[model samples]
Target: MTDKSTSAPSSDSVSHRVADTSPESDRGEQPETIHEDRLWCDGGWTARVIKNEDDDGWAVEMIKDGEPEPALVGPWTMGRNKKDPKPLDVSAFNTLVKTASEVLRRHEQQLRAQLHKRVAVDAATGDGQWEITLDIVPDDDEPYALLTAIDAFGEQLAQVQVAASFKLSKASAASWVENGFRRPG
Candidate 1:
């Protein structure tokens, strides 16, 4: 005698997703597809040729994965007809990707340097060196900067709040350290 009411569902009875056969299913990114006006899913990047909003000229936008906005947007070359954009090719695609990547890299570096500026200055007490840093906090309501000094021993010498847009120059940092990390009047 069998008691069907007490039996639990077997693994085979539970619904399961079938194995994906697409080549990109394993990489977890969309596969590359090319079109006359758009190129996407190629190496985690996408480039599209669009009509310029400001004029009749064409423009190209290169976007990286998971980003809402394009990383690079600039004028695209026109074709012989002079009204349509030149078709995107492999060599052109590679070049565009490289240039866009460089632009992103440089922009990130510049931003990082701006947000966290640092300078080494002579310690106020002696010949020993101290590192001064100005970290900007761009708060929505009230933005500010934290001027900090660290000794060679990695000890916090002093910290003060200054304007968010404060520029940390070598001379200014030296002067600040000499003045006991106080906000210059």
Candidate 2:
């Protein structure tokens, strides 16, 4: 969800921040280009339009700035934010806003997940540290398997994806890995 409200977040005053950081901001490198007039969550993110040198459409880039790479590229536009603005409406601004917002949101989500320790499984190999219990029932031609990796206390460590046509074993899998798995001939 993108909020295009006129109210800017206190932390995200684009004018002030842009002035503080970009050296070219003062020289008017970062001008207030108009478009759908789209602003999200008080400029937390905004899309900016750029002119496409090759085509008739416009190039829209989402400027995150908060992330390592501030400029995130998006699809080009046809008209200026869909409608006519009072002046030379650069629709890229709105596009930038939306794109930047999405990037930020995903970044924040990843951060939160990393910080919280919900599930932890040791992905180490072959000390007999974990046990894999696979029950293959081949009756009535209904072949199936319940693949589970469990700890010492019967607690599930991880669920492994098993194929319905189970034909591979650990030794074979290891050999395949070591051999770089070429065509069978």
Top model number, lDDT: 1
Query: Model 1: per-residue lDDT, tens digit, 64-142?
Result: 8888999999999986557666666667778889999999999989988878989999887785889999999878999
Query: For each candidate, C-alpha RMSD in Å?
Result: 14.9, 15.0
lDDT of 2 by residue, 10-109 (tens): 3322332122345655685454432332332224444544545676554555655454555466445343345322121334454446566677788878
Best by TM-score: 1
lDDT of 2: 0.44
Flag regions of model 2 displaced more than 4 Å: 1-46, 51-57, 65-68, 80-99, 119-185
Error (Å) of candidate 1 at residue 174 is 3.9
Tally clashing residue pairs in candidate 1. 1
- Residue 56, model 2, lDDT: 52
| Cα distance off (Å), candidate 2, residue 175 | 31
Model 1 ranges with Cα > 4 A deviation: 1-37, 54-56, 80-82, 153-156, 170-172, 179-185
10 residues in a row with least lDDT, candidate 1: 8-17
